[model samples]
Structures are given as structure tokens and as C-alpha cells.
Target: MDAPQEARDADVSAIAALDEPTRRRLYDHVVRQSDPVSRDEAATALGLARQTAAFHLDRLADESLLDVVYERRSGRAGPGAGRPAKLYRRSAKQVAVSLPDRRYELAGRLLAQAVEESAATGEPVRTVLHRKAEELGTQLGEQDDNTGVLDLLERYGFEPRREGDAITLANCPFHALARAHTETVCGMNLHLLRGMLHGLGEETLTARLAPTPDRCCVRLDPGA
Candidate 1:
């Protein structure tokens, strides 16, 4: 329903498309070529039947792992010229998957925004970073549906686990960056969760920095 989920599903589908040997072979050959490949050429190069290659190439294009383009092989452009040949090439879409999920791109965007805005407004980078991260978290919270805070947290790869009345995040979505830049990143994370709760209209839980082994630096405590 959300972007992360949608992306994961698409990437999984694309990866699954390659699990078939013939499809994978066609995909590899197409990408390695300097130009888009025609079905006949692909089949000849791979020593596969034309029908077999065409089927696999179509499958790759369906999954968006390959892009299809129609171009005439002949240099002539007259009425008598044959129709354009359908060709296959690599798609520009990027695919990534992590065991525990990660949001490095999100952090990078926040950090970049902080630096650029700090330069423009003469505000401290740290101040801008926190503001931007919180704004983003709020935006995430404001998306469609009335999902619970736990659900929202999990969706964002926080891996939130309940401990009595409190919540501990078992995984940090920005783990590597947070480890490299603890103070700045942890502060950004704290404000992010704070704004998330604010946007979700959650008043009973407080997000605080409570670093622990093998978990996030921020913890959600219940009540005022």
C-alpha cells in the first residue's frame, strides 16, 4: 500500500523473473549489448529457438527489467521499408533489497536538504537536519489510512517491539549512518519519531534517545 511495500514487491517480481534460466540468459545478453537486441539476434547469440528467446524477452520486458523499443533495421525510411523491429535493452529502474530494510536514501536526502538550506538561510546544519527529518516523518505519518503507531513504525523498517507499556525499536532504518554519526543522526531520528507521533495525533507516547545493544538509539516511552 505504501511506497516501500510497492518497491519491495516490484523488486521481488523482477528478481523472480530472473530465476528462470532462459529468461536470465536473455536479460544478461540484452544488457551487455551496446545496442538494443532483436529477438532473432538474441536467439541466435544464445543458440535458443526464436520462439523461446522471444518468449523470455517479452517476459523480461513485462517485469520492467528490460525496456522495449521499436526501430527499423534498414537505414531507409520509405513506404516500402519494413516495419520496425522490436528490441530489448536494460531498464533504468534500480532494485535493492536488504534483510532488515534500510533508508539510506531518505537520510541522504534529509542531510542534503539540511546542508543546502543551511547555506541558503544561514541556519546551523544540525538545526536544519532535525527540522527536515521531522518534516519527512510527519509526511510519512500523514499518508493514507489509520494504521497504528506500531504498524507505521514497522512499515518504516523500525522493527518496533512492545515491552510492557513502552516500545523498543529492534532495528534502525539508518543503522550504518547512525553508527558513523551518532549525535547528529540520533538527534535527527529522535525528532523524526517525535514529529511522527505529532502527525499521527499520538499524545501518550514519548520518543526519547535510549541507546541499547543491537537496537535503535531512540525508544518510545508511554505517557507524559
Candidate 2:
């Protein structure tokens, strides 16, 4: 189970940018500051040559690990401010690569939405959860133009594997949550996948609860 290929590749590239010792040092120094760090300031702090610091800092900026902003440290307006010293700060972007790929944020979003709606409408929490999950799945399927069933499954980290005519998910993206709240989460997953199948107009496969010790609670079976 992994993230989307483009995201995974970009993350790998960004992480690889930190492999160089000098570049890593420059990045660490820049991010630790409350404000952006100037090239000269970083060089002086790290005991590196000014040119060497600039080179590595630029590299980090290219990887999007750092953001570059031009500012005049001299506190001058339109006068001889000296071309606005290039400054480096940690980028607002966050990158995390998890083995077996988890998306707790996605689960949290669904659960939060369920709670809010339930509180607002006085509906049962479980009913709202299942409804929200199904809605999300429908949206995902509607937005998908080219992707098929298996492709969509893999993209979301279900780790789908075909066993004979049916496909069983090898990993659940919400594995931990499902473990803690079996009935609720599993029912939500079943409705979500059923919505997916319906939205995708998949007539040959059926989504059903088929829990096992090693795989996801929901499975895609061929026909009934």
C-alpha cells in the first residue's frame, strides 16, 4: 500500500534532496529560525562558504522544502537596499512518507463531518457516518474519468489483490480505526464501497462485508 504515484515520486525526490550533508545542514538551520534566514546568515552560522551556502539553499528551495522570499534586511525602501537579499524559510508544504501508507487525516475528516452533521440534525451518529462515507465515495467515483475499479482501490491504499475472479483488499487504509470500532467502521466501509460501485456503474462486481484476519473488512466479489 502506497500513495498515488505522482505524490510518492515527488515526496521521494524531496527527501532525496536532503541526502547531501551541507544541503541538509543549511535546510536545518533555515527552518529553525523564527524568521527567514539570509544566505550570508546561514553561511556564517554553519561555517560554510557564502557561495556554498547559496548553492545548497537554492537546491532546497527547488525541492520545495524551503520557500524563497526576497527582502531588504537594511530596512530601506526604494533606495540602495542592494537587490533584496534572498531569504530562505521552511515551506508551508508538509511531506510524510509512511510505510504501508496510512491516511488518518482522511478518516478523521469523515468522522468529524459525521459528528457535526449528527449533532446538527439529531440523526444517529452511525447513520450519518455511513451516509457521509457513501457520499464521499460517490464523489470520488464521479470525479474519476479514466481510472477503473482496481486502479482506484490501489490509489487509496487498499492494496487490492485478485484471488480468482474476486478481488480482496490486502491492506485497509483505516486499519487501526476499524480495529478499535469494528461494526461502525466496517459498515461505513461497506456502504462507501457500495456507493463506489454504484457511482462507477460497476455491474459485474459486488461490495460486501467479508472480514478476515489478514485483510480489509470489505471485499469485491464477482457477481452475487
Candidate 3:
């Protein structure tokens, strides 16, 4: 699935936050240390005012580039150890952006799951692949908080558009693979949408193959 615009925007903002020279330097220092660095330690190491170090570190934490923890550095017992000092460390969050919406990760996941399941059960690879795709689509549809099918499709980057009584999927989420293995990928696409329609209780709509030069391989048509 294509990463949501809001997520990509947040990632971009987080990366932009590090553009400040002092902040970037402070971040570099914090990540280099094996243990989390306290504000006072970072301030001394960077030759900055204590308050200035705190502010930049807090900003990094706010953007989720740094994680915050509390520790008592004095190595003493209750009430004598003094208050816990706030510390900073590199966050585990990963931020990535790709132009034109690459979903190689999702495709790889589906392919890997298909291979594993097929090996375990001795099922045909194609059958396992389609089943896995359909299951994933159903999970996606079920996660919809009562939104309509079109909304769900749009959220997952199917780019649904109306045409008379049907909804045309404008962008294929599996574009690269679809182009390479048209029949196999298109068949999986068809079943995935079918499962999505079922999960949404979409009695008035159905997914069908209606390939065109400019649009996705699947279309949603009115059910009889």
C-alpha cells in the first residue's frame, strides 16, 4: 500500500527539524554515545548554554527523532539519589519518502508470505499468493472505521474515481509488478478487491477486471 500523505508529511517535517545546525550537531552527539545523554552532559560536550541544549533536544524529541528517558545518575538509593535527570537517545522510528508512490515493501511482503505459506501447505504458489492478497485486502477493509468502499480504496491509494454508475481505480497500487506479470498481478488485484467488497458488506457493488491503458486493472461496477 502507498504510504499516506499525512505520514509522508510528518516524516518530511521531522527530517526538516534536523536542518538547524545546532540541533543536528546535538543529535549527532546524542546518537554517538552508547547511553542516553542528559541535557547537562550534552550542553557541556557541545559548549552550549544548558537551556539552549534542553530546548533543541526537546524539539528533536517532539519530532520523534529522539526518544526521552529519565534516570538517576548519582547511583544512590531512595530520596537520596535526587530527581531523575531527563536523557535523550536516537529513536527507532524510520522515515522514508519515494516519489510516484513505490510499494515494493508491500509487494515483497505479499510475495514472501505467499512463498512461505505455499511451502508449508504444498499449495500452488499462485493460489497461495492470491489467497494472501485477498486476506490482506479483507484486513484493510475491516480496519475501515465504517467508511464506504470508495473511501477505503482511496485511503489505500487505489485512487477511485466515478464514471456513470461505476468506480474506476485510477492508480494501481501494484503498478511495477502489474506491468511485469500482468495476468498474475491482475488476478490477485481482482480477488483482493472482491474480498474488500465482501468485508465492507458492499451488496450493491462488485469488483471486476476491466483493464484499460490509463487506469488500474480492476474496476468496481454496480451489482445486479
Best by TM-score: 1
- Please write out the lDDT profile of model 3 over residues 86-167, one tens digit for every residue: 9999999787766555566777888899899899999998999888888887887777556688788877678899988999
lDDT string for model 1 (1-224, tens) is 87778889899899988999989889989999999999999999999999999999999998899999999899778898899999999999887788798889988999999999999999999999999989988887788458789989988899999999999999999999999999999999999999888878888999999999899999999995
Question: Model 2 off-target regions past 4 Å?
Answer: 1-3
**What total of clashing residue pairs does each candidate reach?**
0, 0, 0
CA lDDT, candidate 1, residue 214? 93
**In the order shown, what is each candidate's alpha-carbon RMSD?**
1.6, 2.2, 3.3
Judge candidate 1 against the unseen true structure and give its global Cα lDDT, from 0 to 1: 0.91
The global C-alpha lDDT for each of the candidates, from Candidate 1 onward, is 0.91, 0.87, 0.87
TM-score of 3: 0.81
Model 1: how far residue 78 lies from native, Å: 5.1
Model 3 scores worst on lDDT over the 10 consecutive residues at 96-105
Candidate 2: residue pairs that collide: none
Q: What TM-score would each prediction reach against the true structure?
A: 0.93, 0.92, 0.81
Model 3 lDDT on a 0 to 1 scale: 0.87
Worst 10 residues of 1 by lDDT: 139-148
Which regions of candidate 3 fall more than 4 Å away from where they truly are? 1-12, 19-21, 98-103, 180-184
168: Cα error in model 2, Å: 0.5
TM-score of 2: 0.92
